[model samples]
Target chain A: MSATDELVANNARYSEGFEGPLPLPPAKKVAVVACMDARLNVYGALGLQEGEAHVIRNAGGVVSEDVIRSLTISQRLLGTEEIVLIHHTDCGMLTFTDDEFKLSIQQDTGVKPTWAAEAFADPQEDVRQSIARIRNSPFVPKKDSVRGFVFDVATGRIDEVV
Target chain B: MSATDELVANNARYSEGFEGPLPLPPAKKVAVVACMDARLNVYGALGLQEGEAHVIRNAGGVVSEDVIRSLTISQRLLGTEEIVLIHHTDCGMLTFTDDEFKLSIQQDTGVKPTWAAEAFADPQEDVRQSIARIRNSPFVPKKDSVRGFVFDVATGRIDEVV
Candidate 1:
């Protein structure tokens, strides 16, 4: 079976015990922008319960325009008051620079992308930068609570970016 | 205290019992793109354990250039072979039109986003469209295993988009 088919079968078993819908707004009033890294369990690492936060992830957890778009909706519509940016150690994003990745993609498929990969040299610095982006965005109604962290993949501990 | 401070405290408690890092590659070789719905527990609803999948999420789980960028990194670097897209019911993305949201944001921030929200009227069709986008992308090397699903938020059941 495909991995998704396996997931479907697993969902069948999971939904057998389904109770009811959780609320729309995140209980903790926070939204998370983190890396889509396989090893980083954002919820478990941060002790986030199911309905406590909105975790939005991308390649590097880099704060792109799309992240700001999501944060806009998250704060404006869903009542999420704070944004927490998390980047982890040994992320795949740290593997290549934007120009390098774009060139590779260009060689692979004649199509060049306009968007920057938002690659950075340091994960901690990336988190700090994302925090700054969110803090400076006019879209986020509650920017004072925004913060960033770097997760230690080895220990599953998060250190503040400050 | 800010919500992020609460998360820091929570992480402190969690880190005390932290086991260790899971492997870098997803055991299941799957990457998931899903909505950042507070009520949608992507791991629990799909029965995914930590380290089993790389989940990329945004406001609508829309398949944007960044998602393709992440998937490229997932396949080219991290060894993920499969992509699964999931959209859920009662999505806030369905609550507003792009024109409306754009106007609202423009009014609020005086900055206009060039990117579309990629919002849709139907969740199932949105999943299908995202699946097609992934399949057509040259970035994803393993397009044959791409699949889509709509998770019924009320029942916590996932229906395959096929």
Candidate 2:
């Protein structure tokens, strides 16, 4: 079987009899914003169950305007009362300089890099700034809680940032 | 050894000499925004390497305002030109109603649920709405491309959402 096929088989075996949605315990819904690096498993790290929390991820886990808009809706329309911002060490976002990324794209696709240079630098600072921005954003519930943490890719340990 | 320790050891054994970052093909400096559901592995599914793309994840894979702001920075500063939104089947976001979540929090922490009902609801709609919102948001790069896909938790096949 191909790798994809093997993956599918594994999912079937592990998720068998998982009929539809699982029961959710009565709790205040929590939302986590984290990076999508494959190495980090938020569920395992946070010890969360299927119905425990909402997670949103984007590159660098930097809170963007779209993230804030969604957060607004999630707070105003959904049920999330708490927010967790999780960034990680050894992240891919930290590896590339903007110029190097652009050159790679140009060489691969023959498309000159049209993107600017400010987007991919210093991911840790970006996450810290995002946490501050989100905490101060008017869209977030003024009274709701927000916390930030960094997950160590090598250690599998999470360190609270603020 | 504890389960976590054993798992970490296995990861180290499997990943030894696999360090120094994954290579990025030029045209694929794409950013993936996905959900944090354990059933989905974005990198394995997409056949991506470490530096090829930045993976951002959270609940429902919904694009929030914060995500948009981050995307803007990524495109303008980091050289990323595309966005992939990946939502998966059997997501935990879909399993709970607002009341149950609130009550669970109350029971666990002995604290009253301060948030109202509007904070959390259907995750599918949340994902769909997030896609539309991101596509139309002014914060995203004008030339940047965005697409949405639904990942089958059972099959590992990602189907583009039309």
Candidate 3:
């Protein structure tokens, strides 16, 4: 079976023991922006239960336009107040540069992507950058407690990026 | 204490019994694009462990340009083969219209957002729409196993969008 199929089977077993139908808004009133890295399990690492927080993740958790869009809806419509941004050690985004990646894709497909690849050199620095992006956006209104963290993948710990 | 502080404390407890970093690449070779709903716990619902799959989430789980960018990197750089698109029942996206949401934001912020709010009326139809978007994108090469599903928040069950 494909991995998707296996997950579907897993879901079937999960539903048998599940108790859900939580309210629409997040219980913790926080929205988390995290990396899409496989090993950075946001739920487990943050001790998040189902229906506690809104988890928005992307390639590098770099606070792109889409992330702003997500956070706008998260705070405006859903009433989340705090924002958490997570970038982790040994991220795939740290491996390549934007120009090189876009150029390689252009070489193969004859079409270069217009969007910023959002590659960053350091996870801690990128965490600050992501926080800056959030603070600079007028669309996201709640910014009092926008904190950033760099998760240590090997140690499974997160240090605040102050 | 703030909710962010509370979660940070929880992370300390989580790290106490945590293990070393797993491999960077996803072991399952699959990427899941899911909605950023608090009720839809992707890890628990899919029985996914750390290092299993790349989870990309947004407000509505719409296949936006950023998603294309992330998937491009996931398939090209990280070697993921299958894609899973999940939109859940009772999603916040179902509550508003794109024009109305943008207009409200424009009124509040004095500047309109260029990005689409990506609100959809139905979860199942939106799932099909998201699937079509993946099929149409040239940037994402692996499309043979692109499947879409609607997760039921009440039942914690996923029904494939066929």
Candidate 4:
């Protein structure tokens, strides 16, 4: 069966016990931007539930224009006031650089895309950069409430990157 | 205490019993891109475990350049072979037009963002568009393995968008 087919079957079981109809806004009024790594369960790790917070995931959890876009809307429209950025240890983002990756992808597919890899050497430093990016942006409300952390993939421990 | 203070406190309890050391690559070899809606639990809804799949999320799960960048790395560097694009009903993306929203943000913050909201009139159509974007991108490998879905926020049912 297709992988999605398996997900569909999984969802059948999930919806059989689903309890939703949650409000439009997050109950805790926070938005979390984290990595897309499979091992890091953002909700379980951060103690979030279905109606608690908006969890935004991407390659490295780095702050990009799209992230800012989501944050702007999340704060302005949805009443989310706090922002948390979480990058994890042993991230695929730490594996390569933009130049080398772009070169490699070009070699692999004969296309030099205009996208930025947003790769970083240290996850903590990347978290710091992401926090600074959000805090510095005028669009994001409640900038002082922004926090950054590095979640250890090995231990599931989240350490503040201060 | 602050909102994040609560998360930090909650996480302390979570880490005490945390179990991990999962591998860097996803066991299921698939990446699921979905919305940043707080009501949706990407992991639990799809029955994905800690080491199962990559979950990339943004405002609308729209296929942007950065998403392609991540998917390229996910497929080439990591072993992710299938891609799933999930958009949800009653999404914030269905709330406004890019033109009006950009004007509103510019008025609110005195800065004009170059980013597009990628908003859509319908969730299913947006999912289809996202799947097509991933399939059309030169960077993404295994395009034929892509699928799309519209997850119902109220009932927690995920219907295939085909």
In terms of DockQ, which candidate is strongest? 3
What CAPRI-style quality would you assign to candidate 4?
medium
Docking class of 2: incorrect
User: For model 2 chain B, where is the 10-residue window of minimal lDDT?
Assistant: B17-26
Candidate 4 residue pairs in clash (backbone atoms < 3 Å) = none
Least accurate stretch of 10 residues (summed lDDT) in model 4 chain B? Answer: B64-73
Find the candidate with the highest lDDT and give its number. Answer: 3
Provide the lowest-lDDT 10-residue window in model 4 chain A: A135-144
| Chain A vs. native, model 1, TM-score | 0.95
lDDT of 3 by residue, A82-127 (tens): 9999999999999999999999999988988888888889999999
**Residue pairs whose backbone atoms clash in candidate 3:** none
**lDDT accuracy of residue B132 in candidate 3:** 94
lDDT tens digits, residues A1-162, model 4? Answer: 977788889999999888778887999999999998988899888888898998888899989888988898788778999998899999998888999989988898898979788889999888888988887888887786888999998788899988
Q: Which residue segments of model 1 deviate by more than 4 Å?
A: none
Give the clash count for model 3: 0
Q: Which residue pairs clash within candidate 1?
A: none
Q: Sort the candidates on DockQ, descending order.
A: 3, 4, 1, 2
DockQ of 1: 0.72
Error of 3 at B102 (Å): 1.0
Which DockQ values do the candidates obtain, in the order shown? Answer: 0.72, 0.13, 0.92, 0.79
Candidate 2 per-residue lDDT, tens place, B47-127, comes to 554445556765467665445645654565456777777777765566556576556556654654443322335445665
Residue A133 of model 1, lDDT score: 85
Q: Candidate 1's residue-wise lDDT over B1-162, tens digit each?
A: 777887888888878887768788899999999898877778888888878999999998989888887888888778998888889888888888999888888898788778786668999888888888887876677887877888887898988887
